[model samples]
Every structure is written in C-alpha cells, then in structure tokens.
Target: MLKEAVKKQLHEGTVIPAHPLALTSEKKLDEAGQRALTRYYIDAGVGGIAVGVHTTQFEIRNPEFNLYEKVLKLAIEEMEKGNTPDSFIKIAGICGPVEQALAEAEFSKSIGYDLGLLSMGGLNHLTEDELIDRTEQVAAVIPVFGFYLQPAVGGRIFTFDFWKRFADIPNVQAIKIAPFDRYHSFDVVRAVCHSKRNDEIALYTGNDDNIVNDLLTTYHIRSGDEKIEKKIVGGLLGHWSVWTKKVVEMFANIKDVQGEAQIPSNLLTLGQEITDANAAFFDSSNSFKGSIAGINEVLRRQGLLQGNWCLLEKEKLSPGQAEEIDRVYRSYPHLHDDEFVKANLTKWFDERQ
Candidate 1:
C-alpha cells in the first residue's frame, strides 16, 4: 500500500532531470554550481527533483561519498528558497552492487529525502532468486516509495522474468520501465498489467519518442477476430520526463486524460516540437550517448542551461553542426504559448479540415 502520508502529500508536481555528471573536468561542476544547476531545473517549474550521485549522471554526491549528506543539505537549502519538504519530492539515487545500494540507500534515507531511485547490474545478469533477495534486502530498511529498475538491456531482458518477480517484492513501489527497445517497452507494460502484477506499481515509460502517444493510449491488437484491449500504454506514472517542459504543465496535461484515450491538445503540440528537434538532434548524433550530448548542448546554448556540458566526451558538435541545431532551435518561439506554437496543431487540424 502507498504510505498514507506519501499519497496524501503527493498532490504537488515533481520533476526528474536526466542527472548529468560527466566525469570529465569540463562537465564536472562543484556543489555550489550543482546547486545552481538544480535551481535552474527547479525554476523551470518542478516542485521536486531526482538526483543521482553514483555515475557522472544525476547523483549529487560530492567527490567524497560523504557528500551525499552535502547533496541533501544543498537540496534542502535550494528548496527552502522556494518551497518546503512536504511540497517537494526530492528523490535521491544510489547505484552499484547490492551491498552498496543498501549502504547508500541508508545514507539517502538519513538525508530525509521524499523518495529513492536505485540501480544495479553485472555479470550478464543476476538470477531471479538473487534479484528477489536484493529487492527484499533493500526494501526491508529503506521505505522504497519507488523502484525504477532498468530492464535487462545490454543483455536480454533478465532471463528469470524480472517484471513479475520484482513486482512481487513488497514496497517495490514503481519501475522506470525502460525497454531495451520500443517493442520491449510496450511488452513490459502489457505484461505487467495483464499479469495484474504489483497493481499499485507505477509504470514510468522512459521511451522518449512514443511517450506521449504510448503512455497516453491503449493498444488494440486483434487476432482471429478476437480483440484484446490493453492498458499496456497510457501509464499513470508519477510524471517523469526530462525531454520536455516543467512539471506544473507536464503533470497537469498528463492528468487531464488519466484513464482517457487522448492527451491534451497542448501536450500533443509541444510533443511534436520535441519530435522535430529530436529528429535534427538525433540525426546529428545517432548514438544514444551522442544524442544526450547534442540535446544538452542545444539546451545550453538556448540559455536553458549553464553550459556545464553535462555530458563530457572527446567529440564536440562541429561549429557548422552547432549552427545547424541553432537554426532548428530558432524555429521554436520565445514562449511556448505563442500562436506559432501550434504549427503542428494547425497541420493536424487542417488534415481534418
């Protein structure tokens, strides 16, 4: 059961940035700088934040492990400048071996965060029994209000059936639902729902492109005149998206169609803008790692970020490529509410006209 206090206090909106902590010098920003970084994201309209410290990704860990405490302190300080703990869902991440997650989670819990995000994978993959053991151990101490485990990708979707077994673990509140591919993402949601597994578990679709469509619509698959109505799509997750605008709007739009078949018109419009830019961005980068780097650069130059170069890599977008992306960015209006914002809407509406 969702904690009464947690559920009651969950009305506020939260945002989780794809925590960027590239190990390179250029990408690494100090605690004060990171607090400033977090402030930018918070100012973008999130009531809370999810930060990671293990990888050069999202964690707030200072160079030393003890910084987790500092991260929490900084987050608290940053948030108090705008809101309170009850209004914020400050989630912290801890990833590594099972023992490491346990120790890290203990530290995170002590920091008094609203939630925790944990990750671990090694040696092809752990057996089902081992995964269950790990889940049991973690949830035992930490009030794992959520669990966003990545699917067995870079391997082959955990051979022992992770979805069913992991959901079986009590207090495993949710999963990020990152399919190795589109088909797998769709499959994971379908299987989870069909199996009635972890009925309360939130399914957060991390697949960027199809999120608006996939997490907002049910799938109708027919075979031999038999129609299967699947809620595999249209996830009722806690609204996690780093590729779009702020929370107040993101959650508002998603909640408008909770159980319905359609997303709000505005969301659809904004989603297309993302799709278009992603086309340009991805086309230039291609690799997932490269795509993140490219998008961060674009957001940085647009004055959306501090130009921390969140992802450090040997390759930088060529000056010509930078110009090309800026050209694409220019296509977007100053305010999302501008009349031109609905360019996609006009086209779609015209098709009906």
Candidate 2:
C-alpha cells in the first residue's frame, strides 16, 4: 500500500527525474557513479527519483546485465541514506508482461519503493483490455504510477479509453502523460477529468517538450453541466535528469504563478529554451535514438557520470548529437547544475566509502 505521506506528496506535486544509468569506460555499472548521481538528485532538491526506467536503459533487464534488481536496490538504499523527507517518493520502473511485471512489482515493494512507474512499451501485441488487465495485476501488488510513454521511444499510443479505464484502477495514484503530442496529452487530461477517480489521480507531465507550459496552464474540461479543472502538477522526465537543480527551481516558480491571470513573458521564453535544450539532450533531430546517450553525455560533462556508455554497445550519441549538446550548454548555462555537482562530488563519494 502507498504510504499516506507519500500519496499526499504525489498529489501536491513535485519534480521526479527519470534516473539514468552510470557506467564505467569498460561498459560496466559504475557503482560509485550511480550512488553519486543519486546523491546529486537528492541534494538538488528533487522530490523523487525513478530508477530502472527508460533513461536508466531498459536493457538492464536483460539476463546478461541483470541490473534491474541491483539498480533499484542501490537507488532506494541511497535515498534512505540521504535523509530524504517522508514524502520523497521512490519509484521503480516496472515493465514486461504480467508475470515479469508482477515479480518486479513484488521485489520493488519488498525493497520499499512507494510506487511502480509501469511502462507499456513492448506490449503492443496485447489488446486494450489485455493491457488494462496487465495493469490491474501489477497494481494488485503495489501502488502504480501509470506511464503514457511516447511512441518515438518504444511506447505505443494509448487511447482516451485506455487512460480513462487506467484511472479507474484503485491503486493507480498518478499518471505520467508523456505522449509528446498536444492532442494525446489533452486526451489524458479530459479522460481523467471525466473519471470517477479524477481527484485521486495526480497528473504529471512526462512531456519533456512542454514542461513549463504544462505546469502553468489549467485544463478546463466540460463534464456534463460542470466544468472540471485539472493541472499537470509536476514532471517525471529524462530531460530533467540533467540540470535537475534548475529544474526544481523552475518548477517552484511555475507553481508560484499557477493561478495568475497573466504569466510573465519570461516563463514562456524559458519554456522554449527548455524545449530547445531537450531537443539537443533527447536527440529529437535523430528520432531520439541517442536519447539515453544524450542524457549520459550531459552528466558526463558535468562529472556526475564517468562516461556516456549504455549497456547496449550500439547505444551512443548520434551524429552531431554531442555538438548539439555543446550548443545547448553554451545556449543555456542557467539550465545546468554543474557547480552544484562539483561542490558536492567529493563529499558524496566519500559518504559511500
């Protein structure tokens, strides 16, 4: 069961970065680097950390790597050691079919994860009912954070019906709406607004492309004679993994202006700037083939990662991807947390000793 404090935190909204993998030059898990990255996120003031997710490389689940359990355990261990608040959420990325996802959910629950950020990436073979059935099975084990991952990154497009039915699942505490399409994004909002569990489900934007605006705008959905209102409270994004200190600050500013009639123009400009940076970090130019690598590259640059190596040998920065990352580094220095990571690097590493 989800803790009352943690559930309250999810509803209140907070930044939760899709945690990335840290690797050594030899293409092995860099345990020190991984711990340090966890430390980095906590110290950066993020509300939560999601491990074993897309940005952490789904390849970790392969038998050859067998890092799914290891990564999840390591992150939660670090989170506990960090003296995180009662509301600091620990999310485990749950994937695969029913049996596999169930096992993972059970293991995550055993290890103290508050929610499962369930991914439906490779389940395209299942019909919509089958998909919902799978979700119900997983939720029976642990509280779920439903993910509407964008298709560009191995995720299928879930329809409004799917989302509406998903919201009905009793244990679904939140949904990360990351279709990356405005219409699809709206579909989730409208579906939830119309659901019986609308108030119970907190909407978080996994739409890295529209983070700022997603948080600022309130959706007015006409449900029967009443106009129901909803908002994307926070983000669960890979784009946030890099520059997280700034992301936390930006989220705070966005929250401060939530009900204001006139948003400051600078927030709008910041949104575009963030999107521009995400394009470079997420490799939008290359169909996001290098999205994971791009995230690692930024961390490597900031000294949070030892090197930008993914478990899959073929996974590396795309052509001109590094140059684009450099461009964003130059273009938006304010978005980075280089100095924060630098100041605490040694201390974080020493704590692990």
Candidate 3:
C-alpha cells in the first residue's frame, strides 16, 4: 500500500522544481549552497522538489557516486530542522540502466524520500513490451513517478500505448509530461483516460513551453460508464528553479479559479507571455546550447549563485543564448520574483555561510 500521508500530498496544486546542483569552484557539490537552495524552495512554499534530476546534472553520476546520497541526507536533515517535513513530497530521480535506477530507488526509500521519479535512460533502446517489464520491476521496489521527458533533452517520444500500459501499474503515482509538443502531450492525457488506473495516476506538466496553458486545461475522459474531468495539477520543471517564489504565487492564483465558471482572460494572456519567456531562457532560438546555464545566470544575477557555472566547462552560455536571456529578463519584469529574492538573499546566503 502507498503511504497515505504521501498520497494525500500528491494532488493538484503541487509545484515541484527539479532541483539544480550547486557547484563549487573545484567542481564538487557545494554543500552549504545546496542547503541554502533547499531552504529557499521550502520558504517559497513549493509542495515538493525533485533532486539529482536532469537539472541537477545527473552527469554527477559519472564522477561522484556518493554525492547523491550526501545531497539526499542533507535535504532530509534540513527539512527536519524546518519542522515542515510533512508539508512537502521529496522525490529523487532514478535514471540510467535498470539496475542502477533500482539501486538509486532503494537508496531514496532508505533516506525517507516519498517517491522515485523514474526515467528510463538506456532502456530507450528496448521494445515497448520490454520497457514495460522494466518499469514494473522499478515500481515493485518503490512508488514510481512516470516521466514523459521531451526530446529536446535526452528524452525520446514513446507510443501512446506505452503510457496506457504504464498507467496500469498500481505503484505509479504521477507522470511528468514534458513532451513540449501538443500532439504528444495529448497522447499522454488520452492514455491515462483509457487506463483502469486513471483515478490513481496524477499528471504533472513538465512542459515549460506550455506551463500556464497546461494548468488551465481541463481534461475530459470516460472512466468506464462515467465521464471524468482532470486538470494538469501543477508542474515539476527546470524553468521553475529560477523565479520560484513567483511561480508559487501564480500556482495559488490559478488553483483558486481552476474549476470556476470562467478563468480570467488575463490567464490566457499570461500563458502566451510565459511561453515567450521560455523560448529565450530555454534557448529555443539557438537550439538549446545553454539551457542549464541560462537558469544559473538568473540565479547569478539575483545573487543566489556564485556565477553561472555548470559541472562541465563546455556548457557555458553561448553569446546568443545570453543575449536572448537578457532580452527576456528585460521584457518580462512581471514574471520574475527578483524583489523576493533580494529581500531574502541575505538570510538565505548567511545560512550557507
């Protein structure tokens, strides 16, 4: 059985940022910086966070085996100190080969994480049937958060039938839909509606390009003899990491009127604005050379990061990428929470110091 406490926490209106890694000059985990980042998110009042995921440069897996354990342990420790452990769901990304993913899931459970954000990296080569078998194996060890990551990153598009079968797995709590394409996006919603486990699996939009639109949509599906409607509850996103406090406030406002008679017209307008901002920050114009660095640059400006650094030196922001970010940063003043960061940066950075 799934933990009732966790299940209750896993509903609509939950905003979970795929937490980024804070790196030091020597290219190791910056413990205090990472801790400060965690505290910042908790204070922002996000429902949860996913650590050691793509935003955190899962590349750390190649050189630093023990860092993931350290980060998880420290996050748990800090959360306990905050006295709001039950207020958030702590999810760890478990990717790579099936064996490695299983081992990471096992570790996340031992450290008190609520669920495993499961991704099939190497298994992308497997047939759909074979992939389903592997997914079952991981879900058996711990509750799984299915991932429909976008192809722009390391993600590949899967068949709609793949999602329908995956949803039938009892341990799957939620799926992060980051296809970034509307056609493929609907494919996920369609599959969930057809599944026997429709009510069991929650859908979170990781579609940075369509965040507000995804949240505003109401999905209608036939559950046996009855018709049911669902909304993309919230998001687990890399875009969320930079202007987080603003994202939280926006979520609260959207949730307040999500099922009401008519959503405010401004919300639709905001959707277009958010997509426009994402195009620049995500480097869509330049084919995404500095996606992670772009987020770091925002934090750098807000004094949250030492500099816009990544684990790999080659990952630096391209000239066009930086110019695009500057344009968006100037264009969309309303979308950022820079004032919030400014007010709290002193105390938060001191905690790290």
Local accuracy of candidate 2 as per-residue lDDT tens digits, 1-353: 78888988899899999999988888788988899899999999999999989999999999998999999988998999899999999999999999999999999999999999999999889998999999999999999999999999889887889889999999999999998999999999999999999999999999989989999999999988989989888899999999989999999999899878999999999999999999998899989989999999999888888888999878889999999998989999998888888888898787544
- What RMSD, rounded to one decimal, does every model reach? 8.8, 0.9, 1.8
Ranking by lDDT: 2, 3, 1
Candidate with the larger TM-score of 1 and 3? 3
lDDT of each: 0.50, 0.92, 0.82
List where candidate 1 sits over 4 angstroms from the true fold. 1-5, 8-15, 21-28, 53-69, 85-87, 121-125, 145-156, 194-197, 219-247, 261-269, 279-285, 302-306, 310-324, 334-353
TM-score of predicted structure 2: 0.98
- Over 1-353, each residue of candidate 1 has an lDDT whose tens digit, in order, gives 33455543343213444443322244444554445445554555554566663222433343533345555566656666655445455666756558877887787777666556655544246766776687678877664533333332222354325666666667665555544266666555554554444355555554444456554565654434556554422222222322334334654566567567545687777666655555455333444334444544644543334552543344345445566566665786432322322222233223121
> Residue 255 of candidate 2: its Cα lDDT?
89
lDDT of 1: 0.50
Model 2 accuracy (lDDT, Cα): 0.92
**Per-prediction TM-score:** 0.71, 0.98, 0.95
1 or 3: which has the higher lDDT?
A: 3
